[model samples]
Target: MTAATQPRSVNSAAADDVAPIVQRLRETYARWTRRTPIEQMRDDWDELFRSRAQPWRINGFEAGGVAAEWIMAPDARANRTILYLHGGGFRMGSIDSHRDLMQRLSIAAGARVLGINYRLGPEHVFPAAVEDALSGYRWLLDSGVRSGSIAFAGDSAGGGLVLACMFAARAANLELPSAACLMSPWTDLAATGATFLSRADVDPLHQRPMILSMAKAYLGPSGNPLDPLASPLYGDLERLPPLLIQCGDCETILDDSVRLADRAAKAGVAAELEVYPSMIHVFQAYGELHAARQALASAGRFLGRYFTEQDKRPPEGRGDTRDCG
Candidate 1:
């Protein structure tokens, strides 16, 4: 078969092995959606995720009035760090909700991780989360973390926020992060991607209605759905930092990752897109899945490469070299 028409396969065996786990996840999500009210969903999610114990040493702090947490990793690079935003449609997720994932990310990237508890929807609404994200990143810079040495990362809605953050930072003339990694980013708030319907049956956690509802909640009634800060797919991606995107073929948001990668690459930015077969949204957070581990490791290698390159580059002309001392 020709390259374009060839049957693609990556980790098919592993996908088959994880089918049962994915099924359970699907069933659980179905139950959650059916029984939970929209207003209670955030606290419900917080309680559910908080109940799961994490094995990492985490500490709490504040950045620009935003609550944040740090997942400490041993043997971590002193200067390199990750600013992580959690995914929950910009409404539900919190620092505790993603600590396990943060711990794994810290260990994999060999860098400390700062998980930002950005304001959520149906409460703070549009621009609040994005503002909080920028504030956290600025706090990192102010606290001695060079932009060139830090990487920005997030999953789902958080992933989209990471891209939005990049755009805002670039516009402000601040030095961009060395790299960014996104997992199943919700880049299009318009819900216009073909996969939203084509892959609806396969996606375990999302449906178009729920996606639209979350987007509306986060964007507010008057907010523009295509606002670049709200939906990064509409933004100019030129000159942004190198990007790494991971998505599962089965996800409704798969096209978001694909399209973002295409846009970034077309705009002359270095980008890498990895699609996992038969996987669901943000599969990297599921510790039971092999693809999750593989994706994290790949992200780690990607981060390490950029970090090393940033270290070797000449300090002159790079605006990130301001002495923190």
Candidate 2:
């Protein structure tokens, strides 16, 4: 709900270390009570990125028929790429809003980051954003970026979008990326998880009405939430690449990642889920927070190893997972 609501207890001293920062984030989000128009929201999101000095270089790319940017840290490898999709409920986020986040992730994972500004909703609607993301993936492959060297990543809605792209890619007979790392993935568009109610008191960003509104706008009036393209949670998960999903323990969408992991594993996919204690949605976006740093580092290691092994080896550790609270 808000930072004023105390979080459910956790078992470790690390939670104690991260609790204050997490609470502060919640308080900040709680203060975001007023709703702005979509354009204002986009501007405001970019302002957060503009307020700070950039730690990496950013350049414009061909966009592959969709707006996109290329981000690289000093140590980023050209051959390795992370196809990044920004999360804004499929209606608002841009590459500018997620530039720094991509930079940090690129450095951590030792890969070049390609961030795309896919079509947003209430205008473009469902399948449009998904189509743009698929375009980005297709461009990467056509440009000679090895499918094994590519990994997909996104936060919140973007997280689910990347997964949806995987399903689309497979149906089109395109080689899937080596792996994916979803930050607080919004896998369930229907908002079916029990945590929507249980964690509502502690989660600062999401609530049912707002969630459903975003869903409706992205889906348009006629789109079905259960359509595999709209919500990968309902899709057949077999033969999809490995996945690493990270979500805050206090999120309303906590079970989105939880349920996705459970189903992915059952359907023969490698899905690892990490629930960060006391943190709110997309904690990795707050690079100043310790939990965010730890989470990104973990995701970096996860993707780095996979990037190296994707072309050279078999998926031997496909079902292994390391869970944390």
For residues 194-231, write the lDDT of model 1, one tens digit per residue.
89889998876788998998899899989998999999
Candidate 2, 1-325: lDDT as tens digits: 2222222232333533456655654554454545756676667666765544385545675556887777767766666789999887887778888888998898899787888889987779999989999999998887777899999999999999989999999999999999999998888899999999999998766898888888998999889999989998899999999999888888999988888888887777877777888888887887777787888988999998788554344423211111100
lDDT of each: 0.81, 0.81
Q: Estimate each model's TM-score.
A: 0.88, 0.86
Clashes of each: 0, 3
lDDT of 1 at 242: 88
Q: After superposition, which runs of candidate 2 have C-alpha atoms over 4 Å from their true positions? A: 1-36, 53-55, 309-325
